[model samples]
Target: ERLGEREGIASLPRPAGRLVWVHAASVGETMSALPVIRLLAGQGPVLLTTGTVTSARLAAERLPERAVHQFVPLDVPGWTRRFLDHWRPDAAVFLESEIWPNLLAACDARGIRRFLVNGRLSAASTRNWRRAPGTARTLLGGFAAIHAQS
Candidate 1:
């Protein structure tokens, strides 16, 4: 399943009308994102992408009716483009500290509304990103807004 899905390949067709894309990298993040995913599903179909098999299984068992789970495309520029081209999400909402440069750039280039929810960064991560300040700014600055939690 992962082999086929990794390079932006998906088995399911994108749903019609407004689609919101939410990505959470693992079980913990997925757990944190559930309520937000539920809220967004009320508005439109939500495509929730997770990176691990365990998380995908968890999402399958737990996700709401209007929410669909898929493995996130690998963070390659071409792969990201393929995923975005197929889905064409009206908006992209990402959880926690994930900072996928290629994926964010792809979304930005396509003019998709992007948001970061429960945004957080460890001191080490902050230091790492600070090392490449301009790259961090360009990727994160593209977000329409960021919703950080306590």
Candidate 2:
């Protein structure tokens, strides 16, 4: 399946109890999120969403007990909402640059705590975002905490 497709999202069963949604687009992001995922797993189940098969395989091999992988749905408002509605994660963690406007909006609408880890925006992207500061804020405001690169 394409990374940005929502074909299988609705079929996946969400485990009962608190679940943390951790999104990592690929290998690098997955590697960066593992320690955090493991920690979150200690507290509750973790739903690790990645955008590729390679990353999914890596996650399957390395994810701790109570941690599972799912393909991230397309960034469509309805699909994101469905994903969130079904899983009802207690919190969400986005690794590096994995921001999705629709997904974040759904999270905010649901009052889910959102966080960013090792986030970074390129200088050019920063300048572009500066051009529409309000949009940037609206898109990013859902994050309860943002741990950006130094």
Candidate 3:
């Protein structure tokens, strides 16, 4: 059977307890998250999501035991909804700065707790964020907390 032929996310062996949804923008973010993930998984399961194909592959190689890796769904409302519904994470953490409006809204609606780790507001991105304060504020407000890198 072709992958994704069915309606939802790929099946991985689900962990025994609570799951942490960690989103990484790329390889570096994935690597940086691994240690924290290990620490978190000591408490519960870890589900790692990455936007790029390469990052997914890297996570598959580097992810610790009890950590599952998968590609992140596009930020379209429908896809994000399906992805979240399937995974049903207890908490979420977005590495670096991936501010997907639809995804954040979905998380908010579902009442899934979320965090932004290693968040950096670069000078360029800060200026851009300022230009559209409403949109930026909406996205930023979704995070339960932000752990800035610097």
Candidate 4:
């Protein structure tokens, strides 16, 4: 079933109109993005991507009619490029701390407007990021706007 789900992602048809890609790494993120997905679907087609099969199932059940769910590809450069090229999303909205360097770089190179919603960094994670400040900046800078919660 998982393999079938992943394969289906590659076969998804491009949206007829504008496509907005929303990525949530797992079930919690998927649930949190539901309302936003619905709102975006009203404006244009929404492609919601989640990394977990459980989340995919939940998304399939709950997403609005105009929204479609897909499994997020692995964070390999080629795969990310392929996914982006196929989806051609007008904008990319990512939930929480699901930042993938290769994916963000691909999106940035494509000039896709990127947003980070409900972002939160743990104290330990912040300390870890501080150890690699350049990497942190490079990744976080990709987001046009970040709505973080304390």
Candidate maximizing TM-score: 1
Q: lDDT of all the models against the reference?
A: 0.90, 0.85, 0.82, 0.88
Best by lDDT: 1
Ranking by lDDT: 1, 4, 2, 3
lDDT tens string, model 3, 1-150? Answer: 313412336556556678899988888898899899889878878998876778878987888888887778776777788788888899999988788888899999999999998998889889988899999888888789998886
Model 2, residue 23: what's the lDDT? 92
lDDT of 1 at 19: 98
Compute the lDDT of residue 143 as modeled in candidate 4. 92
For candidate 2, what is the lDDT?
0.85
Assess candidate 3 and give its lDDT.
0.82
lDDT of 1 by residue, 18-129 (tens): 9999999999999998999999888889999999999999998999988998889888998888888888999999998888999999898889999999999888988999
Q: Which stretches of model 2 miss by more than 4 angstroms?
A: 1-8
How accurate locally is residue 144 in candidate 1, as Cα lDDT from 0 to 100? 93
User: What TM-score would every model get versus the actual structure?
Assistant: 0.95, 0.91, 0.88, 0.93
> What's the CA RMSD of model 2 in angstroms?
2.0
The better candidate by lDDT, 1 or 2, is 1
Q: What are the per-residue Cα lDDT tens digits for candidate 2 across 1-150?
A: 444336435445787798989999999999989999888899889999988889989998999999878888888887887778778999998988777888888888889999998999988888988999997999787789999995
Residue range 17-61, candidate 4, lDDT tens digits: 889999999999999999999999989899999989899889989
Which 10-residue window of candidate 4 scores lowest in summed lDDT?
1-10
Candidate number that wins on lDDT, 1 or 3: 1
| Count of backbone collisions in candidate 4 | 0
